[model samples]
Target chain A: MVDKSILLDNKKFTVGIFDDSDKLLHAVNTLKEKGVKIFDCYTPFPVHHLDHALGYHRTNLTIGAFLCGLLGCLSGFTLAYYMNVVDWPMIIGGKPQDISVFTSFIPVMFELTILFTAFGMVIMFFARTRMIHGIKEDLLSRRQTDDHMVLAIDNDQDQSLSNKDILELLKKEGAIEVNDSKEAFNTSLTSEEELTKILKSNKTSTKKTKKK
Target chain B: MYTADIRQPLVTGGKTYSDVTKDVCRPIENKPTPSWWLGFSIAVVLLLVLAGTLAWTVWEGIGTWNVNKSVMWGWDITNFEFWVGIGHAGTLISAILLLFRQKWRMAINRSAEAMTIFAVFCAAIFPLFHMGRVWLGYWPLPLPNAFGSLWVNFNSPLLWDVFAISTYLSVSLVFWYLGLIPDIATVRDRATTKARKFWYGFFAMGWNGSAKSWGRYEVVALILAGISTPLVLSVHTIVSMDFATSVIPGWHTTIFPPYFVAGAIFSGFGMVLTLLLIARHVMNYQDYITTEHLEAMTKVILLTGSIVGLAYITEFVIAAYSGYEYEQYAFANRMFGPYAWAYWTMMFCNLVAPQVFWSKWARTTPWFIFIISIIVNIGMWFERFVIIVTSLHRDFLPSSWVMYHATWVEVGIFLGTFGLFFTCFFMFAKFLPVINMAEVKTIIKDKE
Candidate 1:
């Protein structure tokens, strides 16, 4: 069970694909209300309030940036001071090596602080997301990042809602398409009208065989 | 249902997510438009001219240009300052506006950032070529060289400029690329062919846009914005110092830093408007880059133009008050002197042209803004000239004074840089999503 979280859980996911963001939001609310465990949501762009509506706390990126900038400031000033005053004394306008020249140091120091924050934040983001070089991940639909919003539920697991019930709920909550899937591949869902036609044809064929 | 915000629809015309993708990605995915082909051809021809002129300058030494001993720094430095100034708008729009949470930037920031990178690239060519033996240009770097352990001087403003410009370019590139990754992933997903898939996928780095990943992307973006705001300010401040630290009366003033920065922003917005007006029309992206974007940008042009004009006036007043004969002559000779035409053209273009934005009609009209932007561009070049030449030509001794004119080669090199700028811009328009796909998606109205 632990090994089969998103992948390798054959025929497990009941998927709901949404065309409109509002419809996706409403579906998310209803799914949460129905006690269905939503596997994930895939959107082309970030839907506002989706994370908060899904019950996550705010990100701590600001605090980390502040600390990194402070470090940059310290290093930038110290290096400039060390290089200019202590290491090699340049006689500018007959003035000696004086700390008063720190006023001039502000621009370079400011640049370095910004430089450090940008690099640090990006590195942190990469490490946190595991979005490193050349990793393979599947998108639920080709248009998932363009137009469609997808909601996935693990139907194979024991939960408060059944797969059929979840599918019905998805259709009720304005999902444009609903299908069953396993291992990230869609198992196309037949419409109810088509299902009835198949059943009726099967009954007629059985009667013909009986007559024969 | 989420209110569609039809009153100020950022994406405009009831566009869906797929529509946004289709529009932004159209140029990249499809064949080149006729205008694109024509523009690229012209740019390539101009670029070849740039190559020939640059080759001649390098081979024949800096003497190919009309820069004499009196006016040692000529059109090259002026062009450098102008292009660098134009680059500032991109960073300001992307990073500073992002920090302020101005949502309108979503539509134009991608192209603006691209503009910044290209402008910086054009600006860099001057300093490198000015070094003559461009191969030895790495001497400014803080590498452990074998030449008697000669180290880069940290005290020199030139060295500071070396650090400042290099840092600005690299940071802006990373910020731009990072912004592109998710969109590239989208492109990767949309690609039908193996080659398309591989190239897009390579750039995308398998960005799945997981909830966690999206959250982290925001973190990185916000922090980069925080860092870039100051870096942008420092870049021009340091550029200003290249002249400020000098004893040259026109160049040395306490107000140079802020004045140069304001001028940079002013000129930058002009270029941004120039490009966006043409881009929106050619690519049919009017829905995204609406009239509203143009109006907003014109306001920036006005504000910065005023600050720059104020700086010009204050410099004149201060020059008169200094009681130094050299300083007094510099400002007096600038207006009523032989190069008075350059001085007034700079004044008319930089200070006078943007004043029309005070009228509502001028701000809203694309054609007007485009015209004004061209005027401002010309004005900025003249401003640099009036500052550099007017001060240099008239010295303490009567024998030392000499007038300078840019030879055809110098003019060609300047025009060629435009070729470099446009060629890069056209290529970017062809390959990258002209409008950022990932960010624009967020602004789409999905009424709750």
Candidate 2:
């Protein structure tokens, strides 16, 4: 199942834009030291320390890849075994059942092992990231994927620290732009019922509105 | 104050991070240049030739080329191996270099990977048609079907090739496209036309640079690179096995696997030089793919070329030491036989030519390296021809042996595959940034 992008559903975030990674790293560490929760941080490329600063754990993609590789090995080996040994066993040079029979089969086994690992890790990553077709992306700024670094913390659970305090903290720590963006984005994929109902409601409000 | 090292600045012209985006996306923003049109027109015309020649061959039958009583495998197979070897450099550059954390690859990986995909396509066409009845291609797959309830032979090295090449092509495509996601999103945002946004957006698949998304992207790229290293190595080794497993005197040898792998890389880097030298000149990517990058690639060409040269010496020495008459004759015929000129040409181009790289001036001079690269390309094709033709021309029986040369159809088909390869490359150039913009931006500042 794809993980839905639900970070923007809530209206309580202080989006701090930093020009430099060092400044962003410094701000994330300071906020963590003072027990402020970091919702997310985005950059064009990964920063070395920001994950650790945000208390994010290492991903289990390697583990998933290992398991998938094992699956591929078994699948490849079984196919070779069933086709050669079990089904039509044609004797090429009187070595059909030799002990080293599968030695020639290593290349196929190796290929599938790699093939499965690549497919598995990527699919698992896509699921976890919620990057599916037609899904609306919640972009803080277009430059976030180009040159900008963004730090966002949901201001919901920590009610004592107001948006003003977070803004002050961000500005003091050298964020180029600081603002509250609890505003919902035009993201949710509209359902057929929701679309038709909205059209009907609009028609009811306006008598001359054309509706089929 | 931040000052880049003068001798080895990763990027020149003092480009900023934003400049990286602007420079990479410039070709996409501007309309296609006149030179692009000239190249594209040539490529398109050549593609028509490839299609026409294939139609002619299939209609007239495989006998259109003189694969006769003795030499069953000819130019088609040589072309296949050559293209496959050429494709190897792309995956090697992007996957193996990435695993080693050589950041220099970021400048050239996109174009190189695209080349890999296209070259593999060109490689595949030969094998597909080499089987006389191209329509019955699926007969090789294991299933209970029309060719009786027969299954694919698991012991066959050719079967191993099918699995290896298809897997390599698919995985490389996935890796290349996944790496382009964020960069495509940048294109999507900067697009002025509605058509550009729609096309780029559809491919980008909503890849916002969220922390979670970026984290996942890194993990996947790392794993893909790790797997692709083994995949790329095994692919050419398995291709070599198609010859090595055969009992042909020259083809059967223990050193074929490693030597083939080394030669593949040697030849693959040569092709990369040929394409990149032209690309950097035409696309104005000099700042990103700087002189240092060219020097570094020349060093790789020298190293791999040396290994291949050593492999040639090793093969000849072993053949001489072995008392088998056929083995000794095969190597001798390869050197002093009718095709001796081809053999020496291969030697000069593959071994003696790359030695010029020892001089720093040769490596730094783009035009000189470009000339050497073309020579290396020619040498590699001759190497394949020498291996296939010379060995086949002299069988055990003197009466059965016959000297063979490529018919016009055979040469036309060979020339046409280049058309197919370059056409795809031209299309990729038109649509995408040839450099990995997102990754390059990270290294430009070096201010962490």
Candidate 3:
């Protein structure tokens, strides 16, 4: 059961881009104070307390990691036990092949625990974040992943603020650039069918541009 | 956030956030430089040599190499230990240093972790081929099979190694790739060419750098670091157990775990120094991988080298104090017996050479450190050889006592692993941003 909030889905957002993380943080705080709903904020690097300013709860991913770790621990113990005790217990050099010699199983158990925890946590993270190879991203600005910190306000979430008013507010609070997300992104994220159509069109257009 | 009075700026020359991306991603963005071409060609030639030797080994069987009844585990095991030891600095720098809140690590950790992955790949080759029949390598896994439900030995340290090495490699890779995602996204966005955009975007996995994603990413990185700290220690400890559990005198010491772990870190740092010294200079990363960074690494080399030195002394002292004839003979034989040259070489390289780092100039000087780093790598390699060969060359009876020398194929294969390492490193440097631009941006003085 993946949390819906973790996914960055198709939405009409008024995106604000700031050059500095400090400025972005302040803009986010000011927007929150004025009761403007922030859809999500993206930064080139992690800005301290930006999540808190956006009124986001602390991520429960650690809890997921802990559970996965517990699963790994159990799996490790079970595999070792079943293999050594029940399956084929060969007596080598007069040493006992019973549970009393469980000390010997520690290394394998430890390794399995780490292996499972790491893989499991990463899988869970990817699943929750909707991050996968070759997926089309809704990039609001080219510099968003470079130097800019982006604050996106979904227009659907709060109908009180117009796109122009939001842009003005963002610019007033130190955002270098502000624009409607639809104008900025090449591919629209309205529906699955439309998305595929837009992607196919984008591919052909890119091919045409290459030819030219 | 104000700049702290006590802390020197991590990134010098007042680099802005955009400059970090540009500078770090320059190699990936631009055409390969002449130096890069030179290094890549050398690496490729070495890689070809590696491929040739490996194919020859596989085709000709273990008979191609020189392993005898006395020393069944010769250069194969020695090289295995050498490569694995070299792999340790990556995890130590990334996980252990991160856990300790060492900010200097941010500059070196990305490449160090990549080196860890490559070194592990090199290390794995020795053991895999050492099985003689490499096809049945899967036999170590505890699977119920047609041979009447035959399971791998749960008690054997060799089997423990199969689990430990695989786990270490996979976990290190995952850790490295997870760190690489945001940076990959940066490259994807900045990419101009259609091919670059497609490829980088694909690997970037639609990373939007959302606050929610960053929060989770931070927690996961922290947790992974916590787990990997123990995992790294356990890996070498388990590797040591392959020797410690045996009845052989020099190999059967209880101190092998801590001793091996320390030696691993020592050699690992030495290798890191060797690679990064070249990388920092070649890639124009002097500002990022500053003298302070080199100094910090040399300090680790000093600490771990001294620990290794102490371990050697302690092993000898304990062997003599134990009053056991076999144990005492092992130590004395290492120093005065047929392998005296190897023992003394290990002593000078691992123990004596690192003592020069006590001077600030020795630690700070790149040219001096580079030379010493190479020396340290050589010394660590000799240390493993001495431990494995000296213990096995004279076991119980004089009847089986025979001198061991590596055949040409064995030497070639050993040299080939360097090709495999550097080839992978060259590709990584060419394809990816060597430094973590996103992380480095956070610590940039004016930006902060």
Candidate 3 positional error at B278, Å? 0.6
- Regions of candidate 3 where Cα sits further than 4 Å from its true position: A1-10, A159-166, A180-212, B446-448
lDDT per model vs. reference: 0.81, 0.83, 0.87
Candidate 1 residues B1-448, lDDT tens each? 3354554666677776766876776677667979999999999999999999999998999888898888988898999999999999998999999998777898899999999999999999998998888888888876646755445556679888987998899889989999988888877665654576667776676566655567667767877887789888989999999999999878778999999999999999999999999999898888888887888899999999999999999999998999988888889999999999999999999898899999999999989889999998889888888888898888777799899999999999999999999999999999888888878887776321
Sort by DockQ, top down from the best? 3, 2, 1
- Writing each residue's lDDT as its tens digit, candidate 1 over A1-212 gives 01211343454577888887778888888888878877777787777667766655677767777788889888778877776776665776897666888876676677677777777777767666655665554656656766788887766667698778888999999989998763462112223464355335435543543353
lDDT by residue for model 2 over A38-77, one digit each (tens)? Answer: 8889787777657777877778888999999999888888
Model 3 chain A is weakest, by summed lDDT over 10 consecutive residues, at A1-10
Residue runs of model 2 more than 4 Å from their true location after superposition: A1-4, A10-12, A97-100, A182-212, B1-7
Q: What C-alpha lDDT, on a 0 to 100 scale, does residue B126 get in candidate 1?
A: 95
- After superposition, which runs of candidate 1 have C-alpha atoms over 4 Å from their true positions? A1-12, A61-64, A92-94, A98-100, A155-158, A185-212, B1-7, B446-448
Evaluating just chain A, the predictions reach TM-scores of 0.76, 0.81, 0.78
Q: List the residue pairs that clash in candidate 1.
A: A44-A145, B1-B447, B1-B448, B2-B447, B2-B448, B3-B447
A117-156: candidate 3 lDDT, tens digit per residue: 8988898899888887777666677667888888887767
Compared with the true structure, the alpha-carbon lDDT of candidate 2 equals: 0.83
